[model samples]
Target: MCRLTRLVACLLTLLFLVSCSSHSTQREAQPGLFLSSNNLPVFMSSPQVSFVLITKIQVPVQEGFDQEARLRNTLAVLTEMAAEVGANAIIVTNAEEFAAAYNRVSTGTHFLAGASFDLSPDAFKHVQLKAQAIYLNR
Candidate 1:
């Protein structure tokens, strides 16, 4: 019947639209100092190889994520940043995790009554990574 045909067309159109949507976290490389296809390696000092420091990179660690996954994500982000600056290698200088605290205050007015509350400070652990982006001449 006509209704069935219209319903099928609508569903097909909806499916097409959904399939065309892009993932929010997908990263696209921009044309920069180096080709994105080039795999960046972690630099290890050697007597024969020479490298030049391109720039330094630092990424704030995210809390509440799996340790391995967080490390992988950090590496990916660092690589992307380094690649943008034409670095062919990276040397991780520091990775440190420390305890941090922050205080939260809530204030509200209820029907002409003003109320203010100070919440106890919350403690959390934060990590930071520092690396040097370098270009190696081999």
Candidate 2:
């Protein structure tokens, strides 16, 4: 009974880590200017080049629990995504961190249901990043 319980505990830990993994989606490429939100207006309003929308990016952040890692990862992911889409710059429209209890035991149909029951804080926190993927006009 003791050995069986230990095995079960290990399996549960593995499952939880797997379920909390991060995910990212990439879009097609284009040529353009790459500008952060702070530098947007200067480059965007310039007559020499125009800002074009390549795609919007949304990704689940993994190191959200750690402040330093979260910040680094956020910037890295955005830069990577922009490069993937051949974007010279990325304008982050919204960046936020949120926590919510999620139900992880449901079937495919109801994968994410609001947590009605009390749950541990560590199990429900998540970070999400949303950005406007843009390219510069040649």
Candidate 3:
């Protein structure tokens, strides 16, 4: 009876791990909001389309992780933010990378204008991407 109980526990643990792994893997590949400069000319030329506002969006840096994964997550955040504002599309105007350096080690830090945070000198590295969030009149 003890052996059987142990086996059941082990199987449940395995199942839990497998489920968590599969869920994370599926999320990493999903696409976010529309990103492009191709439609700039078309959107600009049309009188119907109007510019909303220019803003900067930052995605938190993943700690000691894969660059591709970090970028994917960041793009997801940007997409969500744009969607919240009812933006038609996002135009990346510029980007800047920020880091906190301590003992010759650099880590990313996230910051935005008119926002404040309290953190130790050494935090992390953050990529601040400047984008123009636009919404069409019609």
| Candidate 3 C-alpha lDDT tens digits along 4-76 | 9999999999998886531111111223345443333222122445655534344444433454565445455
Task: Put down candidate 1 lDDT per residue, 53-104, tens digits, no spaces.
Answer: 7777766543334555556666677777788777777777664321121111
Q: List the residue pairs that clash in candidate 1.
A: none
TM-score of 2: 0.46
| TM-score, cand. 1 vs. native | 0.50
Clashing pairs in 3: 107-124, 107-125, 108-124, 108-125, 108-126, 109-124, 109-125
Q: Estimate each model's TM-score.
A: 0.50, 0.46, 0.38
Q: Ranking under lDDT, best-scoring first?
A: 1, 2, 3
Clash counts for all predictions: 0, 6, 7
Model 2 scores what on Cα lDDT?
0.53
Candidate 2 residues 95-129, lDDT tens each?
Answer: 42222211232112223356444433333234466
Q: By the lDDT metric, which is better: model 1 or model 2?
A: 1
Estimate the lDDT of model 1: 0.54
Error of 3 at 49 (Å): 7.9
